[model samples]
Every structure is written in structure tokens, then in C-alpha cells.
Target: MRFEGKVALVTAAAQGIGAAVARRLADEGASVVVTDLQEDKLGEVAAGIGARALPLRVDVTSRDDVDAAVAAAVERFGRLDVVVNNAGGCIVQSAPEDTTDDDWRAQLDLTLVGASRCIQAALPELVKNRGNVVTISSVNGLAAFGNIEYSAAKAGQIAMTVNYAARYGSLGVRFNVVAPGTIRTPNWDNQPDTLERLSKMYPLGRIGEPEDIAAAVAFLASDDAAWITGHTLPVEGGVLTGPTVLNPALSKKEYPGH
Candidate 1:
């Protein structure tokens, strides 16, 4: 077990990437604390991880909740070695001109400020234990991929990570960002063939799975990446390298091969 005797706290652990990360960490021998606003779903996720997980209800937007959750984690595990800031979402998807002040605020609060609060609350224990942090950013954050508000906030997260690394490296704490590109999750459930369509956007010819992001998080959280800090690792399936061609269906002419 690479993480034997280690303690980890993962925010937004109810489903998707967060759930996968929680399970991966627990499997690697870490006692993990899983937190989310979805109490029932969070409980189920924690239970599925077996006894090594402690489930907590946390509204990351609330400093009180974030602080209490960190306190609970330390009280239960005695120490904290890693904190995964995976709790964020695109609250509203709209064109830049149509986006409202509330939309921008919500996105920033949840995706950016919320992560900051978690990092802040977990800082003391992390500093004391020489812990590390891994934040979940998006490809949109690194590029003009759309989702204006969400993308902006996610970019801010990346900035925050680099700054944290620079400021806390002396304190024995490391920080990194994981930018995922079109990960296949429940969010796309209602859209027909969404995964297949999105797969065309990646050079790998397939969209990423939650485990893909989880693996990256685990690497950055472990000693394997001890020398790595102030880095934004794009876990995207080569999407950031180049642009994909337009959809074949949208083409006016088809090649002779078909």
C-alpha cells in the first residue's frame, strides 16, 4: 500500500471523479474522509469504501462547514496527509453575454472560493503533517473551450494552485492541478450518445473515464510525484494538443472509402 497509514480528505465525493478518487485512495491504504452536500449519496459512497472512509456533509461554500469537516477528519484519523479539491460544477451554462451576475458569482463561489475554503481549513493539519493537495480543474480552464463562468473560475483554481505551491513549498506542502477533458460521468446521462460524440474531440478517440482522473490524483498525492509541484497536469486525452476535425455528419461531402 503506497498510502499505508496516511489520511486523506476528498471533497465532492458523492459521485463521478470524487467517488472514484475516494475508492482509489482507500484501496491504496489511506483512511479517507468523503464530504459532499448530498448526504445520502455521500453516505452510500463512504459505506461502499468500507470502514476506511468517514462521510461528512459539507457545503464547501460555507467556511463553517469546511472548517468543521476538516476538524472532523483530523479528530477521526489523527492527521491529514492529502486533501483533494474535487467539489465543483458548472452551475449555469450560457453564452458570455447572456450570463448573469448571479451565475458568475455562483460559479466562482462553488468552483473557486469553495476550493480555497477547503484548502484553508485543511492547511494547518496539512502543514503539520507535510501534506499535499490535488485540485480538479477543467480543460476549459486552460483554453477558451466555453462555459465562460465555470471556465474562468476553474482557471482561477489553477492560478491558486501554483500560488499555493510557491507559498507553501517551504512548509513541506505541495499543490497541483488536474485538468480533465470531457470525462464520461453521470452529468452526460440525459444526452443521447454524448460520450460517443465527445470522443471525437480527443486524439485518443475515446472520452476519459473517472478512473483516469482518479489515477492522476493518486499520483500527485503520492510520493511518486513528490518532486512535482506548481504544475497543471492535463489529464485530457490529447485534446489540448490539437483541435479535432468537424463531425463527419456535419460534412457536406463524404470520402470515397465509405
Candidate 2:
């Protein structure tokens, strides 16, 4: 029970990585507020996790919704100690020339803008409590992806994480980012072949699981990382550093032994 008696809020926690973070924190004795667009699924996930779980329906893009979710956590539990913003998705892959306004907006909403809302809504409480924030940024933020819009949004998110840390460090509110590579989730459940393909591509010989990312998020949000802040920790199984086709033009000697 690393987080015994602490309170945590996790966004997009109905399923996938968010769900895993919520469940793990609860198992460690933290009272967790789980938010998602799917309220029924949220309840089911919350129930499965036991007494420390409280689920709320949320669309992270909405500031009011984000505020309400954070407030509810304090109202139901005793205080706020940690927050993990894990609501983003890679819903944009089109090139800038081919991308529509909707494509840009949707990806930005989910990745960068949505995270901004949640962080803003959580700040006062976090500052008061001297709590921590773990934002689920992406490897795309570090390296450019073929998807222009998603990459831009994610890069913005990484910047936002740094911004939060910069402004709040004096207040003792820590902020960090966890950028996962290819985590195994329901996203691949529907396409088993796609999952297998991605797994084969990883240098670790397998894709990551929700728990893998959850472990990192929990560590960042916990007191174990008390001295850490304003960093992007990549849990990408070397994807960000390894020999991926993303930049195949580099010489082996230039990028070797990854």
C-alpha cells in the first residue's frame, strides 16, 4: 500500500491504461476517482477495483467536466494527492495536406487541449496539497510521426507538462510526463493481427501492457519520485531510441546498439 490513505484522480479511466492506473492506485490504498466518457463502463471498472474506486462520466475536453471530476474526488474522499491525465488518443494520422479541420481539432482536443483542461482544473487542489501530476504523453512528442496533427498536439502536451512544473515547483506541486510506446490495450483487442504486428516490431519482442504504463505512472505520482519533476519519462521499450523505420536513413554506426 504505497499510497495508503492518499487520494488520486485518473482521467479516461473506463478502460485501457487509464483503467490500469486507477486500479493499481486503489490496490495500493489510494482513493481513486475514475473518469471517462462511458459512465456505465466507468462504474463497472470502479466496482471491479473495490472500495477505493469512484467513477465519473467525463469528456476531458470540457473544463467544467474536468473541474467537477476533481472536486468530486475531494468531496467523496478526504483530500487530493495525485492526478494522472491519461485521456489522450492517436486519432489523427493524415498528412497536413490531407488533414481536415475536424481531424486537427479532434486530435488536439484529445491529446493537448484536453490535458490542459484537466491540469488547469486540478491545479488549485494540487498546489494546496503539494501533490503530483503524471501526464500520459506519447513517444510521438519526442520524435516526429507521419501524422502531423497528432505529433504537433503531443509535442504541445510535453511543453504543457513542463510549463505546469515550471510554474508550480515553487508551490511544491510536481508534474511529470510518461510517454508510452505501443501499449497493449483494447485498441488492439479488435485487431489481433495489428497487435501482433506491432509487437513484432518492438525491440523488446513484445508490445507493452496497460500495467507497464501504470507502474510508471504510479511511481511518478508517488512519493518515491518526490525529487523528480518537469521530465518526460519514456516507457516505450526503447522505441524512442531504437532502430525504428521512422528514420531509416541514419547510418548503423550513427544509431547503433540501441
Candidate 3:
């Protein structure tokens, strides 16, 4: 068990990648604290993950809420071994011109600021245990993928990870970011042919599952990656590697070596 006798706290863990992460950690023997604004859904996920899971209602946008949640996890688990800052999303989809000040701030507050708040609140405990932090970034963060505000916030997280790692490495704490591509979650639900279209963009020819992200999160949070820190691991099915498209005309053209 990679996480035996360890404690992991995950935010936005009611569903999607967060839930999968919580489950994966718990299955590997960590006592996981799963939190989200959706208390009912959070409870369901916790229950499914078994006795090793604790579900808490947490609104990451609030500093007080983040602090309280961290305190609660420490109180129950005795210590914090891992902190996964996963409470983030593209709350508003719009162009820079159309994006309201509120829209921009909301993305920052929820994704970038929220993760920072959680890290700040958990730093004392993390330092004590020499633990790790795994933040969920996105491929959009690494490029201009349309969702302007969200992409910017995600990019901010990558910066945060590197700077934090540099600041806290001597203290025996590690920080890393996982940049996922188009994950198949409820966010894509009812969007006609959305998954199919997005799948074509990845070299793998399929969209990612929540569990795929979970597996990467687990590895980063474990001792296997002990020497790894201040890094952004792209679990985006090679979308950021190169073009997935193939044209018959382009393929037919070959060098003299052929």
C-alpha cells in the first residue's frame, strides 16, 4: 500500500477527478479527507471509499472554510501527509472582452487563490510531516486553450507549485502539478458530440478518465516521486506533445528514403 498509515486531504472531491483521487488514496491505505461544497455528494463518495474516508463540506473560495477544513482533517487524522488542491473549474466561459471583472476574479479566487489558501493553511502540518502537495492544473494552463480566465488561473497554480517547491524543499516538503487535458466528466454532459470531438484532439484517440488523473496524483503524492518536485506533469494523453490530425495528402508525401 503506497499510502499505508498516511493521511491525505483532497478538496472538490465529491465527484470527477477529485473523487477518484480520494478513492485511489484510500484504496492504497491512506485515510482520506474528502471535501466539497456538495456535502451530500461528498458523503456518498466518502461512504463508497469505506471507513478510511472522511467527508467534509468545504467551500474553497473562503479562507475560513479552508482553514477549518484543514484543522478538522488534522484533528481526525492526527497529521496530514498529502494535500491535493483540486477545487477548481471554468466557472465562466467567455472571451477577454466579454469577461466581466467578477468572472475573472471568480476564476482566480476559486482555482488559484483557493489552492494557495489551502496550502497556506496546511503548511504547518505539512512541514511537520515533511509531506507533499499535488495540485490539479490543466493543459489549457500550458497553452491558450480558449478559457481565458480559467487557463490563466491554472497557469498560476503551476507557478505556485514551482515557487513553493523552491521555498519549502529544505523543509522536506514537495509540491507538483498535474496538467490534465479534456477529461470526460459531467462538465461535458449534454454537449452534443463534445467527447467525440475532443477525443480526436488527443494522440491517444480517447478522452481521459477521472481515474487516469487519480493514478498520476497518487504517484506524485507517493514516495516513488520523492526526488521529484517543482514539476508540471502533463497527463493530457499527449495532446500537448503534437498534432493528432492526419491528412492523406500530407501522409502520402514521403522523402526519397522511402
Candidate 4:
């Protein structure tokens, strides 16, 4: 009941990590506004979470969409206490030589600009509530991944988190980034070797689950993390610890075990 009367807005809440975070927040008594580009899917997610959800079709890339969603949240919930900017996605494949200008721009807009819009729109209310903002960044934000543009944008998110914390820390608003390694979601299931490869990459010997990230978000949103801010936390299964070796199939012959 950490969030007993708090109002939270979570973007990209139709499924995957966003859905998991929204449900977890709602279960702890927050009035959650679930936003996504898919209206029907958003509604279904909200319904499954029970009564404390307001569903909205939102395209985080658009300023109008983000502004309207923030307005809707304030209007419906009376006051906003937390916002989880979880809308970014890696929407395209990249081969450096073949990547188009537009394709690269799209990824930047989705990952960096979209998060900026949410943070800007939610700034006023969060300041008023003395609340928090959590951005769902990627491990690529901290280190590097092969996807050049995507990694750059995610890295921007981490910088934004730090800058926001610096700017708003005095006003009692908190901001942080949660960088998840590979997680077991709908997308992961589709990857041919991601499961095996990711398991090998982590010292924990497994890919992450959605709930793992959700728990971290919930804590950051709550008073439990009142003293914490401006950090890019690696929610990966110890991926940042060192080079890991997968077993039997994908990993090397000898490696540290989880």
C-alpha cells in the first residue's frame, strides 16, 4: 500500500514491461493511467488491472498526444504523483551502410524525443506532488550495443535522467533511469538465439522477467526511494559485472555459473 492514494501515469502500457509496471502500481493502491498507441489493447490491460486504471491511446512521439495525455491524467485522477516513461522501442533493424536517414531519425524520435515530451508535460504536476519520474532505459544507455542509433538515443535518456534530477532535485521532484538487460517478453520470445545468448551474458544465468523491472519501478515511485535519484540502474542479470559465458550451446566451455 505504498501508493495508497497516489496517481500514476505509465506510457506504453498495453503489454510487456509497461503493462507489468502499471498492474503492480495499481495493486499497491495507485490510481494508474495506462497509455499506449493501441486503444483496444490499452483498454484490455487497464481492465485486467481492475478499477484503478484509466486507458488512453497515446503516441508519445507527438507533443500534442503527450500533452493531452498528461492533461487527461490530471483531470481524471485529480493529482499526479508518479510517471513512468516506458514508451520507447527499437522499431527497426540496422546495418550501418544500409540504414536510411529517416529510419535512424525515427528511432531517435521514439527513444529520446518521446521521453522528453513525457517529462516536459509531466513536469508541472510532478513538482506539485513532490513526486517522481522513472524512465525505462536500456542497458545500451550505460554501455554499448551493436545497434548504433538505438544505443545513442538510450544513452541520451540516461543523460536526460541525470539532468532532470539536477534541475528538479531542489524542487522535490525525483528522476532516475532503469536499464534492463534482455527481458523475457513477447519480443524476446521471437528472437532465435536471444534467450540462450542473453542467459550466457548474465552472471545470474537467466534473462530477466518483466516483474523484475516492475519491482524496481514501484520502489522508485514510492517513498522507499525518497533519497534516491539521478542514477542509471542496471536491472540486467549482472550483465555489467563482467563478460559471462553461456553454457552447453551458446556459452563457452568454461565460465562462472549463476
Candidate 5:
């Protein structure tokens, strides 16, 4: 129970990685405030976690909603020790040349500024508790994975973490990022063939699970990483080493006879 008395607020906690992170924290004894726009799904997540969880409908793009959620978390949990900024996702669908100014704004607003709002809202409580933040970035931010707008927004998150870590270290707070490779989330549920093909690109022989990311968040949020900060831990199953698709024969597991 690393988080025995700690309280955590996780954004986008309706499902996938957010849900997993909330559950992981609750399992380790943290009172979790789960926020997402999906009210029904958020309720289910809170129910599963029982009395330790509080579900709230929060639209990260709205400052009012973000502020309200933070206030609600403190009111119910009495304190906030960790903020998991998992509220962002890729929303742009146009090609780079076709992407508009609105597309850029929308992507950055949710993925980048949205995180900032949460951190801002909880800064007071976090400072009082010597708390930390773990942002869910993406391997796309670290490398060229095709979605230009999304990748840029995700990269902004990494940059934000580094700066926040530097600015707040003296205040007893820390910030870090988890850049994950393609995970088995609902976002990819309709793209089974795409996921299967992408799995081969990973050196680990499979894509990541939400729990895999949750474990990293737990460590970064807990005292175990007391000396760690301003770092981007890529929990990407070695995909960053290089995608196996580039040279199939090089992967013995994927091409045994080669």
C-alpha cells in the first residue's frame, strides 16, 4: 500500500489507461477521484473501486470543469498528493498539409493546455502535500509516428513536464512523463488489423497494456522515485530501439527460420 493515505486525481479515467491508473492507485490504498467526460463509464469505474473512488464528468478543455473537479477531489478526499494527467488524446484526422489552424488549436488545447489547467488547479494542494504529477505522453512525441498534430501536442506535454520539474523541484513537487507505444486501448478496438501489424513493430513481440503504463506511473508517483524527476520514461516495449517492421528477418521471434 504505497499510497496508504495519499489521494490521487486521475483525468480521463472512464476507461483504458486512465481507468487502469485509478484502479492501481486505489489498490495501493489511495482515495482516487476519477474524471472523464463519459459519465456512465466513469460511474462504472468508480463503482468497481467502491468507496475509494469518486467519479466526476470533466471536460479537460474547460477550465471551469477542471477547476471544479480539483475542488471536488479535495473536498471528498481531504487532500491531493498525485495528479495523473491522462485526459488527452489525438483528435486530428487530416493530413499535415490539410490540417487547419483549428485542428492545431484543438489538439494542443486538450493534450497540452488541458494538463496545465489541472496542474494549476491542484498546485496549492500538491505543494502542501509535496506531491507529483505523471503525464501520459506518447512514443509518437519522441519519434515520427505519422500523426503530426498529435505528435506535436504530445511532445509539448514532454516539454511541459521537463519545465515543471525544474520550476517546482525546490517546492517539494516533482513532474515526469510516461511516453507509451501503441497500447491495447479502446481507441484501437476497431483497428484490430492495424494493431496486429503494429504489434510486430515492437521488439517485445506485443503492444503494451494499460496496466503496463500504470505500473510506471505508480513508481513515479510513489516515494520509490524520490530522487527521480524531470525525466521521460518511455514504457514502449523497446519500440524506440527501432521498429521490427523495418527488417523482419532481424527479429528472430517474428521470423524464426531467418
Candidate 6:
């Protein structure tokens, strides 16, 4: 029960990595406020967590909604100690060169500025409680993974975390980021073949699960990482080590010396 009396607010908690993070925190004794635009799914998540979870509908793009959720969290939980900015996703559909100004604005607004709004509204309480933030970025941000807009926004998250950690370290607060590789979520329910093909690209022989990301978030949010801050921990399955297929012999489990 690392979070015995701590309170956490997780955005985009209806499902996927968000829901997993909320449950992980609650399981460790934190009162969690789970926010998402999907009211019904959010309710289910809260229900599973029982009395420790509060479900709220929040559109992170809207400042009013973000502010209201923060206010509601303090009111319901009495205090807030952690903020999980798990709200962003890739919403752009246009080709990179064909992408319009509106596409760029929409992507950045939801994925980047949305995180800023949450931090702004919750800063007061966080400062008072010596809280921290764990943003859900992506391995796409650290490398060129095709989706240019999404990768840019994810990279911005890492940058934001570093800057926040620097400015707030004196105030007893910290900020960190978890950049995940492809995970099995509802977003890819229809892409089983894609996941299978992608799995081969990972050194671990499988893509990540939401629980994998949650474990990292739990560690970063807890006192276990007290001395850690301003870091981007990539939860990718060694894909960041470069393509293993380039040298097929390197992909084998045994070496000639062994």
C-alpha cells in the first residue's frame, strides 16, 4: 500500500492504459479519480475499483472540463497527490504532407495543451501535497515511427515533463514520463494481424500489455522513485535497441561462444 493515503487523478481512464493505471493505484490504496469522455465505460472502471474510485466525464481539450474535474477530485478525495496525464492519442488521419493546419491544431490541442491544462488546474493542490505527475508518452516520440503528428505530440510530453520536474523540484514535486511501445488495447482490437507482425519486431517476442505500462506508472508515482525525476522511461520491448532483423543471427537466443 505505497499510496495508503495518497489520492490520484487519472485522465482518459475509461479503458486501456488509463483504466489499468487507475486500478493499479487504487489497489495500492490510493483514492483515484478516473476521468474520460466515455461516461459508461468510466462508470464501469469506477465500479470495479469500488469506493476508492470516482468516475468523471472530462474532455481534456476543454479547459472548463479539465478545471471542473480537478475541483471535483479535491472535493471528493479531500486531497490530491498524483496526476496521470493519460488523455492523449493520435487523432490525425491525413497524410503528413497533406495534413492541414486544423489537423495540427487538433492533434496538439488534445495531446499536448490538454496535459498543460490539467497541470495548471491541479498545480495548487499538487504543490500543497508534494505530488507528482506521470505522463503517458510513446516510443513513437523517441524515434520516427511513422505518425509524424502523433510522434511530435508525444515528444512534447517528454519535454514538458523534464521542464516541469526542473521548475518544481524545489517545491517537493516531481514529473516523469512513460513512453510505451505498441500495446494491446481496444484501439487495436481490429488489428490482430498488425499486432502479430509487430510482435516479431520486439526482442521480447511480444507487444506490451496495458498492465506493463501500469506497472511502470505505479513505480514512478510511488515513493520508490523518490530520487527520480525529469526522466523518460521507455517501456518498449527493446525495439529501441534498433532492428534485430537486420542481423538475423543476433536475434537467436544462443551465441556461438555459449
Candidate 5 has which clashing residue pairs, if any? none
| Model 2 RMSD in angstroms | 4.3
Among the numbered candidates, top TM-score falls to: 6
Provide the overall lDDT of each model, using Cα atoms, as 2-decimal numbers.
Answer: 0.92, 0.86, 0.92, 0.89, 0.94, 0.94
lDDT string, candidate 2, 1-258, tens digits: 889989999999998999999989988889899999988889989999887888899898888888888888889996898989888887866667888999988889888889888878888888889998998988888886456777788789889989889998999999999988888888777888888887665666778999999999989988899999999999987776656565444577887964
Higher-TM-score candidate of 4 and 6: 6
Better of 2 and 4 by TM-score: 4
lDDT of 5: 0.94
- Each model's backbone clash number: 0, 0, 0, 1, 0, 0
Model 6 clash count equals 0
Model 6 local distance difference test score: 0.94
Q: Estimate each model's TM-score.
A: 0.93, 0.90, 0.94, 0.92, 0.95, 0.96
Clashing pairs in 6: none
Off by over 4 Å in 6: 246-258
For model 4, residues 1-258, the per-residue Cα lDDT tens digits are 999999999999998999999999998999999999888889899999877899999998899999998999988889999999998888768687888999888998998999989989998999999999999999987786778788888999999999999999999999998999998877766785868876878877888999999999998888999999998778998888767643234444454452
User: 39-138 in candidate 5: lDDT tens per residue?
Assistant: 9999999999999999999999999999999899889979999999999888999889999999999999999999999999999999999999999999
Candidate 6 or 2, higher lDDT? 6
Candidate 1 global lDDT: 0.92
* Reference-based lDDT, residue 161, model 6: 88
**Which one wins by TM-score: 1 or 4?**
1
Task: Report the Cα lDDT for residue 226, model 4.
Answer: 94
TM-score of model number 1: 0.93
| Cα displacement (Å) at residue 58, model 5 | 0.4
**Candidate 3 structure lDDT:** 0.92
Clashing pairs in 1: none
lDDT of 1 by residue, 127-242 (tens): 99999999999999999987888889999999999999999999999999999999878888887587888888887789999999999999999999999999999999989987
Position 72, candidate 6: lDDT: 93
